[model samples]
Target: MSTVEASAAASPQTGLRVRVQKLGTALSNMVMPNIGAFIAWGLITALFIKAGWLQGIFPALRDPDGWVAKLGGWGAYDGAGIVGPMITYLLPILIGYTGGRMIHGNRGAVVGAIATIGVVTGADVPMFMGAMIMGPLGGWAMKKLDALWDGKIRPGFEMLVDNFSAGILGMILAIFGFFGIGPIVSSFTRAAGNAVDFLVNNDLLPLTSILIEPAKVLFLNNAINHGVLTPLGTTQALETGKSILFLLEANPGPGLGILLAYMAFGRGIARASAPGAAIIQFFGGIHEIYFPYVLMKPKLIIAAILGGMTGVFVNVLFGSGLRAPAAPGSIIAVYAQTASGSFLGVTLSVFGAAAVSFAVAALLLKTDRATDEPDLAAATAEMEAMKGKKSSVASALVGAGRGGTISTIVFACDAGMGSSAMGASVLRRKIQKAGFGDVTVTNSAISNLSDTYDLVVSHRDLTARARQKTPSAAHVSVEDFMGSPRYDEIVEQLKQANADSTPAPAAPATEDAPVGDADVLPVSAIVLNGTGSTAAQAIDEAGALLVAAGAVEPSYVGAMHEREGSVSTYMGNGLAIPHGTNEAKTAIRRTGISFVRYPQPIDWNGKPAEFVVGIAGAGNDHMALLTRIAHVFLDKDRVAQLRAATTAEEIQAVLNAGE
Candidate 1:
């Protein structure tokens, strides 16, 4: 759900695009984890090559001395240097092992590395493409082969069988890779290399920004940079000591320019927030900070594209390039990776791109006086819609206030391995520092949440599911795992509660309270016997009640569909809560709830929903109502009672009984 996009849900080519995005994500996953190795190799190459900085700094290194030539790897010495062996064997095997591990764990990793060595020795050039193929292929094959004899293997012989089977399969794959895959991948790499050559030779490389800039805003920057460009650029760097391709997607200039323009010419929240966003974008090398700005005014994309072109053109004119990929695309990283004699060109490229983008963005913002200043929160929601995940830093732009203290907190995500882990770590530090060390903060997959925590934090898109998993826990929805203003709010809430002589356990009510301590769901908003054929229709039926209650605009209904398309709002236990995408908060006039009980279960994306609760919460106000709904749904007896209830008052009693 976090990986699926709202805009993508509406696109006719959603399947193809999602598949492509998945492929890109997979490829980046293979490379991003091993970036440190790439950087190490790049540093070695930059300093030890024939015309490298080491030789320029220490002239004796340039001589054909045995040790010098052997270490430098460019002279007549016949020995392998640190640079060549690392690029040729170490990096490929590491990548192969990582890809395998991603699929089948340690066993897959071992087999993948074994198979990759065959391609590494078989090919004249680096075997990155071959490693990408063989690693996953080996893992998949092992998984299938294991499945064949899974239960049949004798208990005593299980280890022996697994070890032998893995070794034998790895041997076969290695042989196959040597004889079959090496030449095919080599030829393909060559063809791709030729295409890059053609573009660089014809001065057409800069034109790639037309695709790059737009794709970046869509959150495909990692795929384009690490998956496609980095490998190609590494190959070029091997031959020429640097590659211009590294700068294509990693350039921060365009994003920085847009932020600077917002700082100078933008209005309202965007203007107030631009300076900090600019700092993060330009210096921190987080290009995502500016994406919301672009989403707010799509015309800014034209500026980004043109700015990217300008940077690329300048780099091309000066034949400027980096020795390696700049991981964060920060100006400092870019400068650190700049090739020898390219300082001027690299500086010019960044400044040139910024200047062009700033100029264009300024003109657009100045001329667009008829429209009111954009809502940073709406733009952030739009950004999340396209990105298919919450952008944590972007959430700070909203500056939303918070309340409540919590003793137990759980950071929940789909897998609970990546983002949730990070969020837990971040919040743990804050809690310890706040002297609330006794407070417990942990992370778990939404599915693995067997026990109730006092507070549950999750992505806004996944809040419904989190509530379903732990109905008693107060839920806080956030966009990012790395950083969120909500963390500070939580800390402050605890401090205030302690000041008021309230224990941490007594703060759930404060955290759960909306604007006022009253019921948000009234009898009028509850509708029984709703009729809808599909999930969209069910969502519409539910959303219409909120509209009629003056809770939201009619446009909010469409957003509910879009939100459903991106991530199923299906909470388990025959309940479906249809809510607008976070960006659709602008459509809400006030907090309201609508409950529609379907006589027959509605097909909600493959899940059957007997009850659809449409929600339009204006702030943290909606969270309290959701917590109440979660509690009722968690009780099988109460759920059964509500299903059989004939009167609206009966349903209300079931929901609001204990609360």
Candidate 2:
């Protein structure tokens, strides 16, 4: 039987293994993201707050009742203590994106959104602003803002930028903060929070409460203590509550609900989380324990409500002494004396409520793992980031584009025929919208895409081709044909690289090695798409020309084909260089430099190619010509530039950047 079938056949309690595996994977993904040490940062900050530590750092947010306490909360939490957390808010976005990838493949928007909510509200609201309200809204926007490359260049640039922006720069920020920048950053955060509060307190009271309250409770409350305030940790905290179960430390409503419900669905393993939550609330006074269990399945909102109503009923029926509102966490927080039937009565009420929640969860839900997809962590992070902000995957991809490297693109779906084409079109449109200038976007099957695009975006099973064919191109998978923010991000990267790649003026042409007739040779450039030809054949045709010209040396001609098979040195863009370097000097000489059209296409790199120019240079300083040649094919005006040049002189003129 298949692994999944066996999983189904095993007792529900058997899920403990899966749960442990998943938790391990989740923990691994949380910390081992393109982002740095995210899970460790989260757990650190969690310990800080759970321990009620850091009172020495900010005296105002400290617990007033216990002035000397060194653990738990800053001296002046809430609005006054809101500084350090907000700037790091993007971390939770990363977590949500990663988690979504973990659970649902590319269909991560919804849970990513929910995860965002969990992070934003897992804090002390009175001290911090609520950020969770943005989660669902962000998810909605991501769904609608889908963008694809669609054979366009601009979208690729955007994809490179948006997705990679934080990962690349966030590291820099982390370094800066580690080197004492964060301590000073508080001034800015304080000012920003004050401004937000001023606007809300004076003009939009109710609306502000709705927006800021939950976020403060979930995210910023003791964020610094919880480590979510760190650049990487905050990114994790933003998308998922690595520590929201805090208030639940005192409140039984939401905490007990998920625990009992788990017993119904995956009974045996559920106890791992459920019992842990119960014990923490009973004596540990830690509230964050319940968050992981509840946030595991967002549909647990029903359990939360059921637990809340039951807690309220038992409180009234037993006339339990309202002991400090029980930390809004569990009946365990209540004393045995002033309550209904003492501590025993409270446990009964708690179990009674738990039973109801378990029944609802077991009879109504089915548990399954998320789909398999590439870059799951990054996807989940972006999806989570989109939850509470105006950002979308498309926009974020565009934003991260500036840092991306050149990547080939492939559009893949079921037959490599229709959906691929559709995706290419959407991607192109989004790229145009992002304002990237003149980017190339196209579509072809994985079988035929041997050298065309660098990154393959597809939904189809190209496993055979992926393993057997070229592996340089990174494979990206998506479910819908609508769009991907990543394509635009790549376009942005291309733009930056182009802007940065102004070729240095031709290396003083070496007198040691000379073009026989700088004035007489005819130079031609050929451009081809969706065609394939073998490297060996192209070289053979070129060798025939050199042989006909009597210009080719035997040693030079033999080494050409040998090196071609080793690396295929034909970096495309309507160009191919198949030259073996001199033992000392690496100048390409045997250009057999004419364009050859192949009747049958062959894999060039990983995509299809129809036109190619073989390059084989000899001598020490012949590199100037090669450099010029590389630049020629990189631009979009390849055909026009080549056509205008009737002779070598004209070609050289066009090759020089317009003076």
Q: Say which candidate scores most in TM-score.
A: 1
For residue 319, what is the lDDT in candidate 2? Answer: 35
Best by lDDT: 1
Query: Model 2: runs farther than 4 Å from truth?
Result: 1-48, 55-530, 533-558, 565-575, 580-592, 596-611, 616-659
Q: Which 10 consecutive positions of candidate 1 have the poorest summed lDDT? A: 507-516
Q: Roughly what TM-score does model 1 have, to 2 decimal places?
A: 0.66
Clashes of 1: 1
lDDT of 2 by residue, 255-308 (tens): 555555554454333443455556654455444444434444555546555554
Query: Over 4 Å off in model 1, which ranges?
Result: 1-11, 396-400, 403-659
Clashes of each: 1, 135
